[model samples]
Target chain A: MSPPLAPPGWSRWLVPPAALSVHLAIGQAYAWSVFKPPLEAALHLDGTQSALPFQLAIVMLGLSAAFGGTLVERKGPRWAMTVALVCFSSGFLISALGAWTEQYWLIVLGYGFVGGIGLGIGYISPVSTLIKWFPDRPGMATGIAIMGFGGGALIASPWSAQMLESFGADPTGIALAFLVHGLSYAVFMALGVFLVRVPRPADRAAAAGGPSAAEGVRVSARSAVRTPQFWCLWIVLCTNVTAGIGILEKAAPMITDFFADSSGPVSASAAAGFVALLSAANMAGRIGWSSTSDLIGRKNIYRVYLGVGALMYLTIALFGDSAKPLFVVCALVILSFYGGGFATIPAYLKDLFGTYQVGAIHGRLLTAWSTAGVLGPLIVNWIADRQEEAGRHGSSLYGLSFAIMIGLLVVGFVANEFVRPVHPRHHLPAPPKEAADVQRQQSA
Target chain B: MSSDSSPPRGTRNGLIAFAWVWVGAPLGYGLYELVRKATQLFTG
Candidate 1:
């Protein structure tokens, strides 16, 4: 093949499509919950048991991203995107085989383990690249890519539901849906690979290692751990995700249970609607809330996400079991913030550490999500499960969980407050503007 | 964790700046609303 035409522009535009492809495809993980009731009913599994696929996916997302960060950064976006596509699509295929065989563990292994790798790699691939492209607006660039991740569920949720309805809820049907997903996504993600391009030579030469490089925003992964900023962000994200996922994991039944004896109760259809609304908010948060991080500074924006998010959780815990509209709205608002937290975090990382090795640092940071994924669900589900066994009704079941969430938030708030400027020793000056000069010379 | 700044300024195209604002605003507004509502839940 002829020498690859030097990708025109900063090749930054390629970053969004690349990020979105992985995000949108792996986003199918969020739709795992919709499959649980059917799987449980069909296979006679318990709620906890059926949740394996999603939990595994979340776990894998963190693990892969953590390990793969360096690979993506070194190998370049093309390699990373390709790996994401294959693993993600293959996970579906394996899960399809499991569905056909009525082997639940196969589903767990295929969709959860193998597929999780895709989720993790796909997540980190575009972030560092985007920062490289938009050194001036690290927050905005990362936000755009991350938004794709949050929004992917919007398309996947309904699409999965529809597929299941058409295919029949049995082993054969579920398998068919999984098969279709695998095939379709391979095609979708391929679009990204074909389109993506690394930064041109001139651009790299121009910077010659500057501070503004989004990669340089933070310390090296090793050094980063020693910094307070990383831990502060960890607390902020963990708490925010914990609060949001706390509500999201229980969104359907949580509202209806609260209203079971209330003056105005939530109907089944309304519960479904509530789930849909939350999805909308989740998608919107990825795009809308994160981009905001660009303007306001990632640190200040996170303060709002954590501090305000706490209060919302408190409202639902305190008064949620009473008012129907208030309960629904507040929970949703919290979920939106939760989605925003995921979307905005990359930008936050960019602000703290320079973009050098940001992909790796971000990969490391996502271990926080993995931790929260377990913590959030366990706290909510375990507490509710205990309450149900103890003969408590409605509000009492969630009181303890909500209280725990509040404490997490308060802790997170302190973490956010603890954030100080990066110590000077870790500093890397911004890349000099040679690319601009080159462009000026070319134009003149 | 350095208190350093990098001005790796790319081409100052109004095009990119315009695109940034267009995309960033909605995200900002969404976050602002979430915070505003979370705040209002108490004060309002």
Candidate 2:
């Protein structure tokens, strides 16, 4: 379908904020860890029980994004963003009610299930529209929007912590925080809804003035799934994500273990500093590395992300805890690659499949993230817990996990090497029936 | 598309500035917190 075009003289630059508005708000999901202790204490729940909300939210994010991607593409960003705004805001409000009532299951149902759908839909809603707006610089364009997701936690973590502290950390306080979050995010995301516009057909045509790499292949999301390229990229994304998330999911405690026997053990506050640095690295890498892809090419950048990433893991495995500086540098670099892997993948899809259904394809691809999210932390935490049980201390606790991460990165690197352009056979064919209907309408 | 006309320089600059501010406001706050935390860890 010919999408509605932006008005003449509409600045393409305005679109990223619209995307950022939604991403930054939904990105609050990453900060769910901030609520764990408080929730556990207040609700008289265990660690696993408290974590169910976050875990279920993530699972729902992937599921909704995968299923609703086509809807985002079909209905346009306005429809997608509005749905996201409602689902996301209402989820928070519902969770607030659950909190007030002291119903843990309601909190789980509201935040995990309903809020997660918001995350999924909100995440992919602006992607395709941004690419369409910035055909000239798809990498940079997408990086700008997606970087907000990474940055979201940086904003929410401290803010949420402060709110919980000030509000008293009881059920009443928790409900208040949830209420504030829901209300504020609804206002924040509405900016995107109103500001976002599809490039007019004429503008789109004008924007594609010359034949370009993005015009090379046009694959629908369904067809993209059939291609080896898609699956290869999936493996590449999943493995890379798994490796990074492994360390990230356990950063604070892992650092303390690494330095437990050192001249001075790393303090809890210092470990928090380390985590904050990793978050900085993740956010910076999203923008910096993805923008670099615009210059170096997407496939080549993945080589750096996967190849050098594995080497970074190897460096840490060999010599990490010996020097705190070395350990920090390697960990920061690896985390950056993780963030870059996320920010770059949309542009990578644009490269291989054209813009036809890139958003849908990107949505479907997020299932890999959900998979890695589970697998990565499990591998790292499980091994770490076992090592602690067995009287292992210091770097040895994570040495084995780091080695496994390196192996995963190598697998990703190999998969990246195997990625070639999608075959022409997978490209979407023009539908004659739609063309005839349009022609008949025009004649009438 | 390369064929699309660029918006006026003043308008475009204004839009770019607005876009950056929109995304950068929260990011700047996050950075502030990170810096504050790091400072506390190192100096305090």
Candidate 3:
């Protein structure tokens, strides 16, 4: 309940770097798939068995984020960051032990569940705090911090792969790799916890624009759910996530297969590099694309995302295994947009509803991610897997999946269009003055 | 342009606006796409 302290001389701009350090490190979750094939080969596991850790990790990310939203709002960013550091690092430790012991369930418990809590807490921690620091530009502040999440994999994918190769790619080697990740990240994320500071009362006073400022709206968490806007956004995010993750989870293999029949096919090393390129695109989109949303208005920007994204999915489906460059370009563009979406949504909510409890609102909204995390992959993977079983190769297996993605985008488009201005009726009256204004106007 | 040597209030506000725009725009575009693609899956 104490007022946050301000720095002696430094302006608030210093905080974004503090938030990014943790995000970039934890965002390494995207790079996790890089180790999948090696682990499978070494352990003699099937594709489904090999994918268990990743699947469980995704499930935990959504579930924990959904459940942990209020706790995060009540506790400040420091506590959340501390929990994230311990849980995330512990996940790696537990998984490392699991790897050494050759117990898959232990790996699931440690890496998937324990590590997942870290991912969720780290994601939400600095969001509202950053918004408070730069109230004039919530989108940009959150974007810079959140961008680290998408981009984190850019460092991890290749680096982890090298370490695995150097240490040996077998189970014991994998255990060592996990051990290093756990220890190193603990130190890296701790720096963010130390650096982060909530905006001081004066800054909040300045940013909140005083009592005379636009009577800022506050929506309770329980009531926010009742509004049509929340459901519309849920549909919008769920579909976007479903479409992007389907491709992301299978990026390496999908790229190789897509380019296989082309005149200039992607080689094995190139395929791995290609996933890295997508990581770059994902990272860049988080910074470049979402930041763009600040100018165009959130709704208008989403129109472009949904509309253009569907076209990109269609291009890949229609083009099939054709020009190699076209395939890469389109996939990169789509991936960038996917990253952009993750970065921009916080700002979008801030615009629609004032900053009151937006971090919690954003947390509630992430249930869409949990839903899509399962649904997107299931739709795409199941279709692709079944078709592969049916002897469908080349572009045939993914055609149905791409079409499904398009359908999801269209549904989101309708929901986006449906968003009306949140009426005064939906808001609680501003303290006294606004209520007096209403009384005066009515008497007149 | 103002004849006065002093910076105008409008100019300062504009600069502040531009800073916010630069940072927020890309993320706005990005989240819009996320929602678009999310809904697209079900409709199609």
| DockQ score for model 1 | 0.04
lDDT (10s digit) by residue, model 3, range A1-444:
322344433356646766876787778887787778877887777887877877788777777777787787777777788888999999999999988888878887888889988988888888878887777667778888888787566567656888898999888999999999999888877766765667654555455454223226766556677889888888888877787886787876787778667776666666655665666677778777777786777898788778898998899888857776677788888778777778888877776666667777888898898888779878988999999999988778788888999999889888889876566566765557545643454454
Question: What tens digits encode model 1's per-residue C-alpha lDDT throughout A1-444?
Answer: 111222435345545655666666676677687788778877779998898887888888998988888777778777788888999999999999998999999999998999899899988877877766666666666666776676566566667888899999988998999999999889878766665555553454343334233433446666776788888888888899898888888877887788788776667767766766776677667667777877787777777777777888799888887677788778777777787888778767776776667888889889889889879989999999999999998778899999999889889888988888778687655345644554554464
Model 1 residue runs over 4 Å out of place are A1-6, A37-49, A101-103, A201-218, A388-391, A427-444, B1-44
Q: How accurate is candidate 1 locally (lDDT)?
A: 0.74
Pairs with backbone N, CA or C atoms under 3 Å apart (clashes), candidate 2: A5-A200, A6-A200, A206-B3, A206-B4, A207-B1, A207-B2, A208-B1, A209-B3
DockQ score for model 3: 0.03
Model 2, range A1-444, lDDT digits (tens) per residue? 234357677777778888998888888889998889988999999998999988898999999999999988998888888889999999999999998999999889999999999999999999999888877778888998888998788889989999999998999999999999999889888888877888754454446554355654679998998888999999999998998898798898988888898996788888888888888888889999999998999999999999999999899888887888888899999999999999999999999998878999999999999999989989998998999899988889998898899899899989999999888888766456534543444454
What DockQ does each candidate score versus the true complex, computed on alpha carbons? 0.04, 0.32, 0.03
Lowest summed lDDT over 10 consecutive residues: which window, candidate 2 chain A? A434-443
* Candidate 2 vs 3: which has more lDDT: 2
How well does chain B match by TM-score in each candidate?
A: 0.52, 0.66, 0.55
Candidate 3 lDDT for residue A209: 53
Give Cα-based local distance difference scores for all models.
0.74, 0.86, 0.74
Candidate 3: segments with Cα more than 4 A from true spot: A1-4, A7-10, A34-46, A169-172, A205-215, A252-262, A320-322, A386-392, A425-444, B1-44
Q: Which candidate is the best by DockQ?
A: 2
lDDT of 3 by residue, B1-44 (tens): 11244244445455445434443443354344444433322232
Residue A440 CA displacement from its true place in model 2, Å: 22
